[model samples]
Target: MMTLSNLTSPFPIFHFIGIPGLEAVHVWISIPFCCLYAIALSGNSMILFVIITEQSLHEPMYYFLSMLSATDLGLIISTMSTTLVVLWFNLREISLDGCIVQMFFLHGFTVIETGILVAMAFDRYVAICDPLRYNTILTNARILQIIFVILLRMIVLLVPTLLLLKRLSFCKTNILSHSYCYHPDVLKLACSDTKPNSFWGLTGLILTSGIDIPCIIISYIMIIRSVLSIASRTEQHKAFSTCVSHIAAVAIFYIPLVSLSLVHRFGQSSPKLVQTMMANIYLILPPVLNPVIYSLKTKQLRGALLKLLLSKNLPMSS
Candidate 1:
């Protein structure tokens, strides 16, 4: 007697592809990956530590930056956990539950980061366009509320998507592109009706990026209007300089994301390596570069970092 479980292995295990065709050089690939992960972990951790310890860094702007760093850390840990294991050790098999867990965190963190960036854009809008009301508007209580709402939004949209996934039986090929468990990658392997899963996935994406991208754009437009209204060029430059880091952050985060989506949607014939590497970039680049960007671009963070580093060395030198 043949059973469905016997044929498909209910809760089928999935396998990972290490760079598609370049399987032999996963060792070389992991070298830079390990380096990037090290920098991302240490850098974001340092940013959070500095922000927490230094009383001067407790303002609303730095608080938002701390949230960004924390999101980046979650993203890095979620995706990189499987990546390094596959690249360095050649272990590629993952249980269905494990893959689903990875998918949840990866998608959740990505959405959270977008929300945090939008929040930061609003933070800048308040700082520049309504300077007098900045602190009053972005109070500690309000910031906590904002964070809670974002997490709630993530849960509200994502939980049903995962639940829909659980109801589907994955009986197709269990190979996934990239080293991580991506939503679309997992969805296609389901051998059951997936319209509900797809709809929820799209709903989650639209609610996050569809709304967020516009809010960020509108916030900056207002910011630009306020900056140009200033009489002195120096003041205008000063105001614009404050926004450079944020603009850079937005660009780095969005560009790779858009590219990866386009590749998946339109470039179906493209090499798996292209899609795989793009996914890697979308996950890894922001974490590795955001700390460097903030540390170098934000004057107060830079000074605090230098002071902390110098203080540590001073005692050691003696």
Candidate 2:
């Protein structure tokens, strides 16, 4: 006889999804998730270590790779706290303020990662399209400036939407579709008129991912043109090869993001589990795969990684 209306509190509590209609299997599901979290954490951690310690990886390219790894780590940790506990212990509840904090970093790092990719694209563009300018264009100071702009942009674009959340009323069901706090997921639960939230949210996406994706595409196109102009076929191949890992990184980061957006915007009749899975993929796929992809694709990183592993495993001298 209890209604959702009566259960509403002064401060709302949000519940994260646990595969919807498959609650009985949450414990079993946690196993793979736990393994994934381990891979994400350890893999990114090792990547960071090798990039920092290996003199070979201290170039502009590897510096960007380090930023990519660091951002992936941030993305993983953002969701790990709420998501793992919800699945393992049935602790699905989070207060409004908590949800906002999670959304901030979850989305903040996401934006940072996007910007890093853009910078990486620029790095590649300069290295190939204008080899002489590569050093001057992407100096350590310039990299620092790019990072500062990314952080500043994240704050400029993301903070206002979250700040506005304090003014909304959650009179409806507060259960979010994914195990992490997402902006759209939380925005929909607000009973107050949310046109401003919707507006700024869409505007942020337009300004962030919308602009970044095209810049990457254009960078690649220019890269291809530059490669084709090279007389020796072997050098062209080598130039293209360097871009493979970066291209892969960009694909994994944006594909799920685009697919999730499409599903949410048009797939109203789709199952809740489908949306939940889509959102999970959006968050988990990149962090889980980036380290492996880079390790396998980049010879320098792979070699450094192998050396580090062998050194740690070798027997100590008496």
- 56-82 in candidate 1: lDDT tens per residue? 999999999999999999999998879
Q: Each prediction's Cα lDDT score?
A: 0.91, 0.91
Residue 304 miss distance in model 2 (angstroms): 0.7
Candidate 2 lDDT tens digits, 1-318: 986556556788888888899888888998898899899999999999999998988899999999999999999999988877888888888899999999999999999999999999999999999999888888999999999999999999999989989888897468888898988878878877899988999999999998999999999999999999999999999999999999999999999998888877788689998998888888889988999999998998999999999999999999
lDDT of 2 at 94: 89
How high is the lDDT of residue 175 in model 2? 84
lDDT of 1: 0.91
* TM-score quality measure for candidate 2: 0.96
Q: Tell me how far the alpha carbon of residue 117 in candidate 1 is from the true structure, in angstroms, after superposition.
A: 0.4
